[model samples]
Target: MQEARYTLDDLLTLMQVLRDPQQGCPWDVAQHWDSIVPHTIEEAHEVADAIERRAFDELPGELGDLLFQIVYYAQFGREEGRFDFHDIVHVLTAKMITRHPHVFPDGHLGSRRQGVAAVDVDTSAVGQRWEARKVNERDSRAATSHLDDIPLALPALSRASKLSSRASRAGFDWPDHRGALDKIREELAELEVEIEAGHQENMNAELGDLLFAVVNLARHLEVDPEQALRGTGQRFERRFRHVEDAVRESGHPIEHTDLDTLECHWQEAKRIERGQ
Candidate 1:
């Protein structure tokens, strides 16, 4: 006999059992939505990390962990009589169907029944339509500003990119990447001035402005600033580990290594990384 494959209903049932007050795992039973928020965020980042690292073998497990976070939230909502997994699924499915007019029957691009091939559809127009639909959704919610729905809990870089995109949609953005690059230079100058003044508070604010300007530049170049920064951090770790290994081979602790010697090791690490 073939082994049975568990369906979404079975997953929901598993979550329900895990959250049962009398017989569930204590940790699972004790978790509320708020308590799981950090884990949810972490699982999301882990999924991203797996993709960034091209760890295809780990992708399924990472994705499952992220899905479990959603399941956990749905279970909490079910307990409170607010919503459930099916409600979440329903809303998501409806939203996708509503968003894809080129593919959906009621969409602007006509329907599959009209014999429109996906390859023949104008993707740029589809993207514009998607954005317009999102704006409509925002309006329906009575959002006071274009940026009103941006999540405050987003990572600073991601949030900055989103905020910039929202403002751009309102015609408040730079005309081009050149303008963004100039703004970055201007911000850097302001930061330099603050640094020279030796005022910690002003320096802090100026530095934040500088970083935000760089994020704007990244946006103009169509780069996800959060992902770019994460990639840079990974590269730094890899290079630093190479330096550490070099130091260990030299029989000296890193702290005792001279700056020039460490710099040499770093250069070597870069050369090696570049296949030089």
Candidate 2:
């Protein structure tokens, strides 16, 4: 006897059953669009975390959890008479096929460009075509500002990068990374002025502006500001934990460790990380 693998149909059936009004689990029955949004965001972050941490063994499960968020939304759409999972799949497939004209010459899933390897395609042309299509799509949706389509729920650093990128495309940006670096210095000066003034509200506003300027600099350098910050956070965690462990080995609470001792352990952690 062999074990059976569940298929997409089975998953759809499971979702339908879970949302059944009369017989579904109470918690599943109680969930709605708004209630599930937080879980969707969390699942997305977990998937990113798994990838960033290079946990390939856990990637499948993390990806499945992220997929479940889509399924959950599809079920809600079904109950509200708007759409369902198949509708979502069809729209996505059709839209992608339409966008990728170089790949699908006939504007369809079944059509493919023959005798052309993907590497032979001009990436610059492809990017231009993609952006042109996106602009047309935005026009069809009556988008007024380049920034209008960006989601407010995005993490601030990522959003700042996107906002600046959009502005750059609209001819509002610095000519190069040198200009971006100069903007960071200008913002930092303003921040310092606010700090010296001891105005809490102005300081907060200036600090935000300074961080946004840094994000713009990151964009110019072709780096993701959010991912860079997350990497820094991980390094800080490793160094702090090393300090904690050293204090523990000395039979003292980390809270009671002197600043100089903690600094010594932190430096040691950095030295070890550098393979020194």
Please, what is the TM-score per model?
0.93, 0.96
**Candidate 1: worst 10 consecutive residues by lDDT?**
105-114
How far off is residue 138 in model 1, in Å? 0.6
Output the TM-score of candidate 1: 0.93
lDDT on C-alpha atoms for all candidate structures: 0.91, 0.91
Clashing residue pair totals per candidate (backbone < 3 A): 1, 0
RMSD of each: 2.1, 1.3
Q: Which segments of model 2 are wrong by more than 4 Å?
A: none
Q: Which stretches of candidate 1 lie over 4 Å from their true place?
A: 107-116
Q: What does the lDDT come to for candidate 2?
A: 0.91
Pairs clashing in candidate 1? 101-107
Q: For candidate 2, lDDT tens digit of each residue in 48-109?
A: 99999999999999999988889999999998899999999999988888789999999978
